[model samples]
Target: MLSVYGVAPSEQLFKGTSEAEFPAFHGRPVGGPVLVDCKVSIVKLGSHALGDQQSWVWKPVTQGYAVALENQPLSSLKNHLRGLRTLKDESGQNRLWPWFDPRYLKLVLRGLDGDDLVRLFGPVTLFAFALENGVELFSQQDGSLQVKVVSKC
Candidate 1:
């Protein structure tokens, strides 16, 4: 099974459910919290869904709105991801990190060192993102990061 997380820019573009979704806040909240509808959501994809929408899903992924990872248990993975939602910046202030965004993900994969990558990846054995004309695959081997690109045919 593959774990997929995505964000819809607008409500009209959102077709998924709110079952396992959360709001994407800009920064740390100040006074009383204000609630608003969010388009961010997570879903698990099995072989059947992947087989059917392999072409469909890849397009949006290439546009940097979503991402996929493998080998982590659902509950644990969700918790792990939740833990990563906030990051401390240079000034030691909490900031929202949309790690699921493919654009941000690409930067993270390239910027982080081996040790950081290991922690960031956690139990995810494989990570994939679609490019303009190909798919980028990331994995770890012998304490190193390995990347491969499969061009669309």
Candidate 2:
């Protein structure tokens, strides 16, 4: 199965290297307490068999942006989270595999605002997105997070 590795960006190892040199990787070590070390299957991103299971629907908001809405107002994501559990032994960690429905995962992720997206898909996946958008995260004076797009990647 294709996997998503969350490789950390090491300053000591890649300080002067270009973005192209950052390894294209996925997944993380298994059986760890922290979720940043667990691998998630890319196959989970495949379309679902139950077409209506989608919790979010997107509509174009602008030329390059779209907004997602919950398919049902009463059926919030918190209810569906009960079905999203990690392996029997992998409790206390955030990695959910073998049981997670990618569709629902997408919905939950879509529901999260900018500040909540810091750990979305772990560092490597976020790094890939930052690289694509030429953006990086920074802390504000008030302790809030912000996205800063760099002139050069």
Candidate 3:
């Protein structure tokens, strides 16, 4: 389950749900009071680990700038990550590291393409499924995670 949380450019993108809220991690680097009144887009990369919240943390950027990520199968995401990693920067060095390092993944994610952004994170696992797009997941104040439909206009 790859969960991408962001303030959608417009509220009209979502259907079935009229609004969604992004809990403000104020004082945090990715802090936000993100409130989507109309709708927000949610993309499902694939099935992932059921527990462990740390594995789901990706970049700490705000909506339209970054994505909240969850893990997927390495076999499905490796090629995309490798391709992004091989890209050269202004200094002519590999833009990303060849190895998987959680500490550095956030920085690397900032440089990924939108299409590739779907699965820019996750634990190095083999049991996950292939990537797909559809339902969005969110946690309620009661500590339960729920799913909603997301679409782009």
After the best TM-score superposition of candidate 2, give how far the Cα of residue 98 lies from its true spot, in angstroms: 8.3
Show the lowest summed lDDT stretch of 10 residues, model 1: 29-38
Q: Write the residue-wise lDDT of candidate 2 on 72-151 in tens digits.
A: 22122223323334432335555544223223333345444554443332221211112232322222222233334443
Error of 2 at 72 (Å): 37
Which parts of model 1 have CA positions greater than 4 angstroms off? Answer: 1-19, 28-38, 47-59, 63-71, 90-93
RMSD of 1: 5.7
Please tell me which predicted candidate would have the highest lDDT against the true structure. Answer: 1
- TM-score, candidate number 1: 0.67
The estimated TM-scores of all candidates read 0.67, 0.22, 0.26
Per-residue CA lDDT of model 1 for 1-153, tens digit only, reads: 566544333332324443355555564432224222234556544433322235433235444333355655666656766776666668998766665555666677777767777877776666666666665767777557888776766
| Ranking of predictions according to lDDT | 1, 3, 2
lDDT of 3 by residue, 35-150 (tens): 31222222222233222222222222112222333454433333443343334567886433322222234344445544343344333222111112322332222222223334
TM-score of candidate 2 versus the correct structure, residues matched by position: 0.22
